[model samples]
Target: MKLKFDSFLLALLIAIGLAYFFPQAVLFQDGKFIEAVTTVGVSLIFFFYGLKLSITDIKYGLKNWKLHVVVQLTTFMLFPLLVLPFKSFVANAVQENFWLSFFFLAALPSTVSSSVVMVSIAKGNVPAAIFNASVSGLIGVIVTPLWMSLFLDFHTENVFGDVYWGLIREIIIPVILGLLLQRYLGGWASKYSIRLAQFDKTVILLIVYSSFADSFSSGVFRTISTSYLVYVFIGVSVLFALIYGILYVLTKYVLKFSVVDQITAIFCGSKKSLTHGSVFGKFLFLNNPSAGLYFLPLMIYHAFQIFLVTIIARRYHRRKEEESQ
Candidate 1:
């Protein structure tokens, strides 16, 4: 499975490389058609996310109410608050829109499938991960916008108010409908989960490509430097480690959960969803040219978390082996 994931990632890299090198070859170089394709890809991602989620699991997930609340609070509230201070330092170094973009990234929803997948790989509590992750998205509708209103002072330039409803319609509604339909098709959804997840990943890669491609084609890259972004990337890495590390310590002394539940709480608690980051950026920063800049931290962070957690998950696999011994 690890080998196959490496292969999939390699293929995705190759696909992105092609988009980078031959920008014209990117499906629909014309902005109108490309936008349509982007919309479709976004919808597909949410639709599959809905299908992959189970209705029965949701009921069971609600039983662990405390875990869900903390995870959401951290993802939507505390994480954003933590980044607010850094804005003053980066203010002179980075552009306002760029700073706004990253600030918005921090407030977006937590991931669902990958969080649960990481917990499962680490032999953690799958059910709790599912519930906490799902709950974040549902709560994000209110939380995300409120988070934006705090920092979003310039309505004319950012146009966040106009774009907010579009995003809620595109991403949120589909996910809720998917959850509601779970009773009828949840089993079928499970059977095809592997295929659907791959499809979803493809959609995400497409989003990444289109996002960067749009910025590249518009000459947005010229305004930014690789060195500056490197610093932001480092910030993202440190932030990722900090969140997971804090979760680990809290789970140990505070949560007092079993090993599996601890791992679930840590991974689920530490994550911010890239899919939501992308979808929201499209809505939240529509007129803003540096949309990709905001997501830059998160993209790097997402890639980092996925590979790093795999290593951590393997340790748990070995621990399970020793316990069985």
Candidate 2:
């Protein structure tokens, strides 16, 4: 029952601690500097993602239409629906913010690396996992915003229009450009995938640090008590378990998937992407005082999912080995 702690999760905790104690460190409190750095970093992250993407794997993955549909619906639709009922109970702005954080966590995409890696470890359908994970991010770029627009009204004039435009400029355009050059550079991207992943985590850490720094400096967390964070942690835990459990039943019994496909379905369907959470939050919550509050649930969920899934994947791996004998 021992679970290994991910170093990046540790780094995330350290990033938050640093932001708390030294909000102004590296001039992050100034806003514009960190904004500029993270903006470029976000684009580069997506670009590298595009460069490393495999069109063949996606095509191969599409053959499993039933599994793909189930996983996609779980990720984009069911997760949000599970949380939507609570919105009616949001009695005040503070409650709404917490609710919105939960909604955002529900709306996010699946993790690409972790989902595929875990599926592989569990002797699951790896190609489908890769395809589902990759497509989930692209889908989230559009879907996440539309979901948020239903609940959030921006201060800017022409808010939705501006948000879409920023998404195109910062995320979509870079991905497109990277895909275009992927034919020439894709190999290089794959060769350096591990390094690029490190680069991605670095950007995410910077974003986390900058976000919390702003929140800390502006006294945003003062509005939030330690007890509220416990509630959020419990909230995300329930959301993760609920979705994971639902996918398990649907894939195992209803869909009658092979154990491999079931593994892919549950793992890819239940996870959310912190990388996307960080990048999309920058645009969605731009200059909002509560930006850090919005990200808190996602960070907690990201860490929790990794811990829980690693255990599940390892057990599946062990069972497969035993059966092979």
Give lDDT tens digits, candidate 2, residues 1-325.
6777689989999999999999887474566778888889999999988898888999999999999999889988999999999999999878998999999989888899999999998999999999999999989989999999888886459888888888888888999999999999999999998899999999999989988887888898998788999999899889988998899888888888999999999999999999989988988887777888999899999888888899999999999999999
Model 1, stretches more than 4 Å misplaced? Answer: 1-19, 22-30, 93-98, 152-154, 157-161
Q: Clashing residue pairs in candidate 1, if any?
A: none
Q: Give lDDT tens digits, candidate 1, residues 1-325.
A: 3522555556556655665675564445456676777688777667667867766777887887767766777787778877788677655535665566667767878888789888887888788888888878767767787778776553675565566667777777777777777678778888988888777777767666666666666677788777867777777777887778777887788877778878887788778887777676676655455555676777767777788887888888788989999
Candidate 2 is scored at a TM of 0.96
Cα displacement (angstroms), candidate 2, residue 294, comes to: 1.0
